[model samples]
Target: MRAVVYDAPGAFSVREVPVPEPGPGEVRLAVEMAGMCGTDVHIDAGGFFSRYPLTPGHEIVGRVDALGDGVTSLARGEPVVADNTVLCGHCAPCRRGEPLFCANFYSLGVNGPGGFADCVVVRAEKCFAAGDLDLGTAVMAEPTACVVHGLDVLDLRPGADVLVFGAGPTGLVLAQLLAHGGAARVTVAAPTARKLDLARSYGTDVTVEIDRSDPARALPVLRAAAPDGYDVVVDATGAASVVEICLGLVRDGGTFFVYGMADEQLSVPLHPYEVFRRELTIKGSFAQTHCFERSLALLRSGRVRTDGLVTHEFALGDYGLALEATRSDRSCVKAAVVP
Candidate 1:
């Protein structure tokens, strides 16, 4: 087997490594495709505390090559995707129904070996049949699951006006979910015209081009798109600077959902009294949890499409180039490593 291994922070190498076999209750998957995300970039740059000497890809899809003892639900050569985050079921948070914050939480590609290799092994229960879903699109299951979790946090009313920031892959997926979940109108604001154009194709009713040099210039346009203010305002840019802007767009008594993975040390200046006065709901949505199945079902039903979203790909050996492209290439909606 061959794998992309991170020896340490700011270091990596692709080399021939021994193929791993599944332990009991696990299955080995021949890596088909693994989607690259901002998290991978973070992991590469030492921005995350992921255990090193690792194979860093979480958005993965592969064909089952072998199943371990007691694995009866799956068979060899079945296409599948798995939940990478491993939780200790008896943790205090898990018992509290908050396993996302479990006391002992770890994940593949982060805390353990992952995709980004010719083959990877995972727990059998974590694997889901990718039934007829294209491998490239199946890689979106993790992200879509995150978006579904965000939607769960929203608990929104049907037919409400919505405003979304950013138009990247996740932004577009969020838009589609909002539309399908019954948002009367969904508007997407992004700096890139091409992405906005693609957002339109994803059913966003309006797109606003924000000038990076002067983002405030788009405020009037966004306001005009929702003259009465939006029932829900979402920030998917993952930039701290955009938080206040999205907060301002939320209507009184409306929800402002922070779905972006902003800088950890970043802080926003928000007035407590304002929130108290407006009775506003400000929420933060984190990683995917218990939403993978529905995410796959959405792909199966054709409610979410990735034809225009997966714009770039690289081979396993070109991992560095893939990261560079993800950072510099605005045109690449979703970058994947096709093994």
Candidate 2:
């Protein structure tokens, strides 16, 4: 077997490794397609909850190759999507019915051996039969699940006017979800024109192309789009500068949602007096909890489209190149590693 092993932060290599066998209640997957995410780059730099000696590819779509003892729900050769999140039921947060805040969280690819290999072991219960979904589309289940979680946090009021910043894969998904999830009008802002075009095709009401390096330059244009300000403002770009500037776009008593993965060290200034006077709600959404089933359903129903979402694919040996392109290449919408 072969895998991309990260010995530590800023260090990794594609090397031959022994194939792992599944334990009780687990199954081994023959990796078919593993989606590369911005979080992977974060993990590579020792950010997030990354654990050393990790095989870090979380968005996985594969076929069940072997089943462990007591795993009778699925059969060998079944196509499926694996949920990467693993939580300890005894954690304080879990006991409080908030598994998202579990004290001991172990996400495959972030803090455990993941799908960046030819074959990887995962809990059988986490594997959802993809049914008739295309492999490329199925790879989006993880991210869509995260978007689902973001929507859960936002809880937009009916007919609310919403604005989303960013047109990358997750950003596009978030915009589409907002468009259908109760927002009367959904507007998307990004640096790329083509991505905005894509957003329009996905039911976005309006699209604005802002200079990524100078987001403030488009402030006048954005204000003209909705002079009263948006009922809900979301920053999906994960850029601290963008977040700081867009926070002002939220209407009075409106909500501001942070859906992007920004740097841990980054900080943005907020006016305490304004928040107090406006009665604003500021919320942040992290990785999902028990949302994969809905994510897969949305994808399967074509409500959340995946066409043209996956713009690039790479060989397992070229994982580093894929990661670099994902981080720096604005032209690359989504990158997948075909193991």
Candidate 3:
């Protein structure tokens, strides 16, 4: 099997490795497609804590080539998408029905061998059938599940106004989810004109060009575009300062959802008094949960547009090229690696 291995920070290479077999309560997948995400780049850059010589891909879709002991719900040859979350079912958070907060939680791409190869072995419970969707579309289920989690926390009412920061894959998906959730208007802010155009295609009613160098200057422009102030503000940029700016842009009683991962420490002015006075709700959503099934349903319904989101694709051996393109190409919306 050919896999991309992360040797160290800023280093990755395609190498031949033995194909894995399913273990107890696990399933072995003939990996069909995997999406290149920001997290993959972070892992490759050692921005996150990860073991070296790792295979870092979690946005995966494949067929059930084999099943481990006790696996019965899924059949061999079934198309599936794997859930990254690996939770300790008896942990405090898990007992509370918050598996995402499990004390002993780990993820596929981060904690174990991931799906960027010819074969991937995952826990049986984490693999969900993709029905009749193609491999590429099925690979997107993971990210869309994250969007579902974001929407779950957002709790936006019909006609609520939304402002999405960053027009990347996650942000675009979030915009479409907000639109489908009955948001009256969704405005996407990004530095690149191409991404903004992509966001518009995903039903973003307004688009603003943000100055990456002078992010603060975009606040006034965003305020003008959302005159009444946004009812729901989502920061998917993963930049701490950008998240802070999003918090400031929301209306007095609006909700602010931080869906991005800020790997570094961020210092920002706090307004505890304003939070109390306005009764605002600020929340963070990490990873997907039961939302994976919801994401599949959304894809099946064809309510959200994913066609334009897949702007680039590469062969499994071209993982380096794919990651580089995702990081540097302003026009690339979402890149997939097909094995």
Tens digits of per-residue lDDT for model 1, 157-263 = 99999999888789999999999999998988888899899898877898888886566778898887777689999999777667878777888899899888776
Who is ahead in TM-score, 1 or 2? 2
Question: Candidate 3's residue-wise lDDT over 1-339, tens digit each?
Answer: 898887777787889998898889999998888898888877876876577778888898988999999999889998889997788889998999988888887777776788888889988888888868876577779999999988888788999998888888888888999999999989888898988888887678999998877677898888887776799888888886687787678898998888877775556677999889887888888887778889998988876667777788899988888898888888788889988
Better of 1 and 3 by lDDT: 1
Instruction: Order the candidates by lDDT, highest first.
Output: 2, 1, 3
Worst 10 residues of 2 by lDDT: 240-249
In model 1, what lDDT does residue 243 have?
A: 81
Question: Which residue pairs in model 2 clash with each other?
Answer: none
lDDT of each: 0.86, 0.91, 0.84
**Which stretch of 10 consecutive residues in model 1 shows the poorest summed lDDT?**
41-50
- Candidate 1, residue 294: the lDDT equals 93
Superposition TM-score, candidate 2 onto the true structure: 0.98
- Once fitted onto the true fold, the runs of candidate 2 whose alpha carbons sit more than 4 angstroms away are none
Lowest lDDT block of 10, candidate 3: 261-270
TM-score of model 3 relative to the true fold?
Answer: 0.94
Candidate 1: which stretches are off by over 4 Å?
none
